[model samples]
Target: MSSPLFTSVHVGGRQATHRVVMAPMTRARSTQPGDVPNAMNARYYSQRASAALIVTEATQVSPQGKGYSFTPGIYSPEQIAGWRLVTEAVHAEGGRIFAQLWHVGRMSHADFHNGDLPVAPSAVAFEGKIWKVDPATGKGEMVDCPTPRALDRDEIRDIVSDFRRAARNAIDAGFDGVEIHGANGYLVDQFLRTTSNVRTDEYGGSRENRLRFLKELVCEVAAEVGANRTAIRLAPFLTARGMACPDILPTILEAVEFLEAQQVAYVHLVEADWDDAPQFTEEFRRQVRARFRGTIIVAGNYDVERANWVLQHGYADLVAFGRPFVANPDLPARLAQGLPIADFDPATLFGGQDHGYTDYSPMQQAA
Candidate 1:
């Protein structure tokens, strides 16, 4: 029997070996001072090169875009060179990679930004705690995020340019493409949700205006690098940890239509963060599929069986595995061979060494 997981798929004219994709996961392992990608990360990504498409961890575009400690960036030359090592390592094994560009928006503390307050669509502060690294002890610290400064019109233009520069840097770093991190309550997402953006300017007040920043970013990046090499990730119905959005279906439809017009490579959607949250109904799924003519990758707590079913049923063209890929580097092979998946240690999910990052052994090694 043919396995849908192993079926070959084409994204942006490039043929992928399998339908399994490695979703971008923030490990928070990059050391401070420069946030350069190191050999350890290179090895970590190379180990999972079997994925048809490996969207890298979220990388901030500029210093002002930073939200957490130890996350990598693509703005600096040193950072670009560092990412080059990772891309080269992954490509050596014939794997395609995409860099995820990010900005934390209101989900950041001044401690990580040289005493500068984090920026957001509005001045509202995220009503939760964020994990930061304690410089004194080098351990993770839970800190309350402060209210952000609402970006002015000029600031918005500068932020878009930052994304454009980051896209250029990703290409220079040897990435096959770049995935704009428009999801998970980041800057782009802050503008999308009505609760977060209460401005009366051109960026806010209505649904169409709310999606302006993200749409402009997509167009700008697509101009820099062809639309075929650009993708966007969105968390449509996610409302947790102060990341709430009202009327998700209509908002998503608007964004999807805009993306369709741009002819982007794909639209990566995260239906909801929590399992108990409403799943994407077949009708809503069809609506998105009809709106987006390009590839569609659905993620968020999907197992092998569900992933295969979604693909075979024609709901999603590709399925992205997040925590599963972290705990199982050989996830594609395991799904192909029907091998047992090792349990993931949730305790070691963030800010860990090689214990959970690169130490997940393949089935052959375990045997």
Candidate 2:
């Protein structure tokens, strides 16, 4: 039987030929010094152009928004020119792509900030290691994050403006749309959770207050780039970044209400992937659909069968395959033909040449 995943769907004005989206996964393969996208990045994305949508890995909106080394940015003219190659390549293969705009916030080290502290919603530490490129060795490695300085109210507005500028820059770089990286305990997620945001100001305290930062950021971004071309990713139960809270679900629903009010293109729900991770109930899915009116996309370790089930059940409009896309560039075809898929090499997953980058071809192509 043909899966519903292979059916066409409309995301905003673009017509996606398949429902399988290649979710954004960061591979630190950009050129150094400027951290710009290059032809190699273009080749990698263009190869996987079969997916209905390709969300580019989390891109830093500004120098201060950067969390790790070698990740691409959309802030500079050079970066925009560089990303043009990737977008053109994807378009050449008839693929749709979106830039996942990111600001790491407290999940950052001081090395990228000229020895200054990283900025966040609060002066809290994330309590884990973040990936950074070694200045001396010029290699990517895990490094501890320092205690971040909280963003002043004025500074908060500036950061939101940065997101708006990034969205405009992304359009110039040839992206079809932009996905605000509000998930994974990043800048916006920090403000959403009570554990990270303990502020008593207008930007924090209550759920609506915590939702202010994200709301303002998305609103400004959508204003700059029409709401039809704007999207946001949210992780309701992800505590890996020490962002666990009791009220996170309600806050997510509240944010969805605003997002629907803005008529955003879609809301990407990132659930836990591992077997040990908590699974959200079907009731939650119904709740999300009730709140958001546009499209709902679901990610986190989804396979063809499970993705088909959700799409058939009217829970999600699209299914994003992360690691599978990492390994199988022809992921949609592989699912359609029920062909054997390859497993990715984790060691070469980040900061590598062509070994694990673009070398992985389809089973037929390899044979």
Candidate 3:
């Protein structure tokens, strides 16, 4: 019997050879100062091009949008050029790739942005430490996030335009499509959650208004890249790093309704973190399948058995693997053969060299 995970499916008008996706995991290995993608980064992505679809690490749209040190960006000409090399390499492997456009919102420290204060939907500070780049040693440093300024009406408009421009730039960088980074309590998620957005304006105070920015962003970006080539990611029930969305089901249902109305390519959901927390319930999964009309992609601590189970039960159309794909470059082949998976070293997950990034041997290659 053939696994649905290995079956071909169409996403945004492009036919994917399989249903296994490489979920975007930030490696923090970008070249310094300008935050440009380099040959090493290109090789890393190219090596994992075997996935049916590869969503690159979250790339910030602008400098102020940055949160972590050494992560790449897509807002400048140099950054675009650097990403071009990565996209070209993946294309050479006959794989589809999408750029996860991101902004950290208030989840950043000034040290990461050259002493500029981080911005969010409201003037709220998260009770967590943000990782920053040391100006002197160019190393990762833990810094406290400062209070952010609430984006006014005009500022909100500019942010929406930034997303549109970023989507256009992703096309120029040779990505098959763009995935709006609405997950993990980023800018879009900040606005979506009432805990972060305290405004009484049109962008807040009601479920419809809170989701307005995301809807507009999707509509605008889809216009630039076409609805078939646009996707969005959301951490629907995530509550990490001082982020929480009350009434998760209703909020998610509302989001699904909005996405269905927009006719997006797909909605990627990070149902839960890998940790043992009850983030996504079976009822929620069924509700998503019932409400969402397009392709559904689910990520979070998923192995081959779980991936097959979800697809077989119609919970999701695809399963994205994060750490597994990072450690095992040939993750699809390993799953296909039911090979024992390798464990990823958490210590080398962030800013390491090629040791853990690209040195994982495939089952056949190792044998």
* Best candidate, lDDT: 2
Worst 10 residues of 3 by lDDT: 240-249
Q: Please give each candidate's TM-score.
A: 0.96, 0.98, 0.95
Q: Model 2: what TM-score?
A: 0.98
The digit string of per-residue lDDT tens for model 3 on 1-367 reads: 7888888887634687778899999989888768898888888888888888899999998887888888899988999999999999988987789999998899888766567778888887677676666658857767777888787889788888888999999999999999999998788999888888888889888988888988989999999998888999988777776677675458768988888888888899996765676558888888888888788999988877788899999989989999888778888888887888888888778886788887877777877
Task: At residue 49, give the lDDT of candidate 2.
Answer: 90
Residues 232-318, candidate 1: write the lDDT tens digits: 999877787566666656987999999999889899987775758866688888888888878999998888788878888788999
Model 1 TM-score, 2 decimals: 0.96
Question: RMSD to the native, candidate 2?
Answer: 1.1
lDDT for 155 in candidate 2 is 92
RMSD of each: 1.4, 1.1, 1.6
**Model 2, stretches more than 4 Å misplaced?**
none
List candidate 1 segments past 4 Å from native.
Answer: none
Q: Who is ahead in lDDT, 1 or 2?
A: 2
lDDT of each: 0.87, 0.90, 0.85
